[model samples]
Target chain A: MDRTAPLPLALLRGTATVLPRAVISAITAALLRGLLKTHPRLLENLTRLEPAIVHVIASDLPYRFAITVGRAPITLTVVDRIATGADAQVSASVATLVDLLEGRIDSDTLFFRRDLRIAGNTAVVVGLRNVLDREELSIANELEALCGPLGGTARRLARALEVIADSAGARLAAMHRTLHPPGTEAQDLTADVRRCHEEIAALTARLGTLESRRKRQADKIA
Target chain B: MSIRYLELVCPAGTPSALRTAVEAGADTVYCGFRDCTNARNYPGLNFDFDELCAGVTYAHARDCKVLVAINTFPRAGDESPWHRAVDHAAAAGVDAVILADLGVLDYATRCHPNLRRHLSVQASAANAPSIQFYRDHFDVRRVVLPRVLSVEAVAELIAETGIETEVFAFGSVGPMSEGRCYLSSYLTGLSPTSEGACAPASHVAYEEIDGRVLSRLGGVTLNCFARGEPAAYPTPCKGRYVTHGQASYLFEEPVGLNAIEILPQLKGAGVTALKIEGRQRSRAYVAEVVTTFRRALDALERCDEGTPTGQLHGNTEGGKETCGAYQKGWR
Candidate 1:
């Protein structure tokens, strides 16, 4: 069990480099189609946004995903060559993107931290974000559902990925700390802010704590 | 010492948010339809009728109540939408319908008299006479107070009105008269009262220039913040304007109102419920804020060391939280 293992992102980057582009596209397309099939309400909810193409770019990765919302037959496509003139573009690390989907992090908090950058039509972006937030999305649950019969294995693998992501977040925070050590009083303020960001990141990583919610309910019953 | 039982009413923009709030220990969850009939009528937010019915079922099974918000004013010629919303809410079996407009309230009173009605903060019913008007005419059971009233004022109103008083516990702090101010229409032709959104997203924009992010509404620059500085919704009231050769917040700064610390004072004030705003925000926001307040309220009930500390940071709109007018030490 190596703590600080940045596995998921590295694994995806490695697979992208080794696999043919067409094959990767086909796999992601199937997964996207499967997700839509399972979460029909999610697609219906997104249809309220004005018809537009939204680009989601993972700054650390070469690949980008573009989604068409509010139009008949919504589509999600993986692209390497960027398309121009998207209605809105949200660029962030894949981890942050996943957190946004899971609602592990509040988008406004991320905006305040500048961890996520959004460009283009503000209205479309706002609409898209609100629509996505409506769903109780879990990448692990989607994977399990996509793998019928082998769902347990998929669920276990998803848990492993989550563990790796949690540690990778800590490693990134370590790197950030190394880059900015405490200094003069003004710099100390910056350090304090950095610590707050780290705390928020830590809090976000531990968001799936259903045990406490249960405990609170139990306390009330008692 | 016995702590008064104060209900926690929370906002849920979507079906998922409603469930989240319920699971997070909200005594009651309030939501709106996906149309202009409600105040949080943003694109892609809120429930359709079917979703609302399902949400009500989900919440009732868990002993949590659901309230539908028909808080926005209906157009003069088009009262059907508002009227239809009340009918739909009644059909959905919601606990109550929170209303603002006089015409719509009258319709609910006459058409669906059995349905419980609550006065929305949008009505700006800050005084006993105004709240009593809704109570006597509409049979309103409760009134959600505006953020403008002080603790003393709230106690007085509760005593006079003799209605269930719901005060804001947490969320955005608005300075203008609720449900009445049209300062936003000056900037964007869409009426906040009619459209149900202040600075409708279509008219909102953000730009980065010279190391600052400028929030503009209807092409009018509202506030420019340095990189990493907290930004707020570019509504007219929250804007920073240039006056007297100095750039300052002309009306109010972009800050969030957090009254969790003052629950004791409110409970003593004979408040019935505390409402957490932000029906336009994410379900994550709902989960976090609801859970934090739930714990604080639970602790208050047991009279433990209060204020579930460190849980309230970085969870506000303007990136800052204030006690707001509830404890106006400056005033």
Candidate 2:
């Protein structure tokens, strides 16, 4: 993970850092259980990745997780550090990791944007990614199921917190833009360049259609 | 209204993706084994023997065919793995075995004479004589055309050779040379030909330095993207390197081949199958690409004229798509 990489989950990261280890353990256990229940082949598929221990680092938080892929029942434990050597390590912000787990954003897209970092045994990491990606997961669904009667309240609270965080992010961006007028102009130019690409694509498609039609007409004439 | 449109052959790296493609209207779903037997041999991706069997049953029940790609060349004196892949795929009752290796093709021809064989693009048989050689030698029922051919060239080759032709409809256009690319091997010591993966994700890394993202393969910097710019894969061919203190892509740019707009031309060019290439992609990608092409093909079957362009740009690499060489728009 890049030290200079800006992590946007400030409110969540602050909250997670202050939390006790016991609470983190409990939440981790429940989330793992939820994943197992939701994805039936989770254990079976992971067991194939024998001897590949995956170290997952939430770069913005104080916690890291070690998931032993080859172990039956799939042991994913939350620890303050990577206690043992790992075959592969994946590092990303808490927000990005959550979005990835819940299938909110595509993994390759994140990889292309350099938002997430993957290292070590290519096969092991790729296997872990594929196994996880095979399932359609949702943190909201897991939260709802993890808590019994308080599930609704938890969901609503989480939703409210997300809204608040987003609003804060937007306002911060606006303020930053107000302070930095040069960036705003650059952003506008980027938008214009994107529009040009779209225009070229549309024109290319139209021309290709006409070419195809002309070829068919040429065949008819022959 | 019995308009026979081209068959939609979709890629599935996993058994789950295979089922998704089948459900999403793929006429045929192609996949490789979990190892280096098939080209998309990425980590944690592809199907095991049992999974392949189940996938075959699932696709067969839905009238969707399954093609096993054992396309990678067998290493000298280490041919058993590739040979067994063909045997297993044949026993698994796959609709066909897509093969490119000459020795493996011969083995399949001699041992499993009943098995159907499709000439993989890895064969790089572009000309009519090359196609005829594969067809006559291995009894190849179809040939996946390389991405470099124009529609006229494709139509001419098909007319001359008279065999089933499959053209890439969407996916990353590997450096124009199909089977002979060793650029990744030069950098990573792992060959896509022998390993079935180009620029394997294991050897790839992305580093952020001074507010720019540097995509590297085998510790060699491939491409650097500015913030807010669409990024490309870290394959050797797409690298932007400096010669005279100015960096630019030498071989090709980082644009994906999108043949959706030119599907009508492809069909008219005597293309038998339209291959959507991305087995290593997630099921979400499989479903989305397959569904989009399915609708377009169905509409084409009904003589509807709307283009299937731009709808797939969301998932395309570099946020940009090209008609590839199908139109040769530059020429």
Best by TM-score: 1
How close to the true structure is residue A39 of candidate 2, measured as C-alpha lDDT? Answer: 80
Query: What are the models' TM-scores?
Result: 0.85, 0.80
Question: After superposition, which runs of candidate 1 have C-alpha atoms over 4 Å from their true positions?
Answer: A1-20, A144-222, B1-4
Candidate 1 lDDT over A10-93, as tens digits, reads 455555567877876777677677767777877776776798998989887677888888877888877775667678889888
Tens digit of per-residue lDDT, candidate 1, span B1-331:
1223679999898888898999999999999988999988888888889999999999999888999999999998999999999999999999999999999999999999999999999999988888888899889999999998889889999999899989999987776899988888998899999999989988888777876888888999998888778777778988888889899987888788999888899999999899998898778888899999888888888888855744665878667888888888666
True-structure lDDT of candidate 1: 0.83
* TM-score values for chain B across all models: 0.97, 0.97
Report clashes for each candidate as comma-separated counts: 0, 4
- Candidate 1 to truth, TM: 0.85
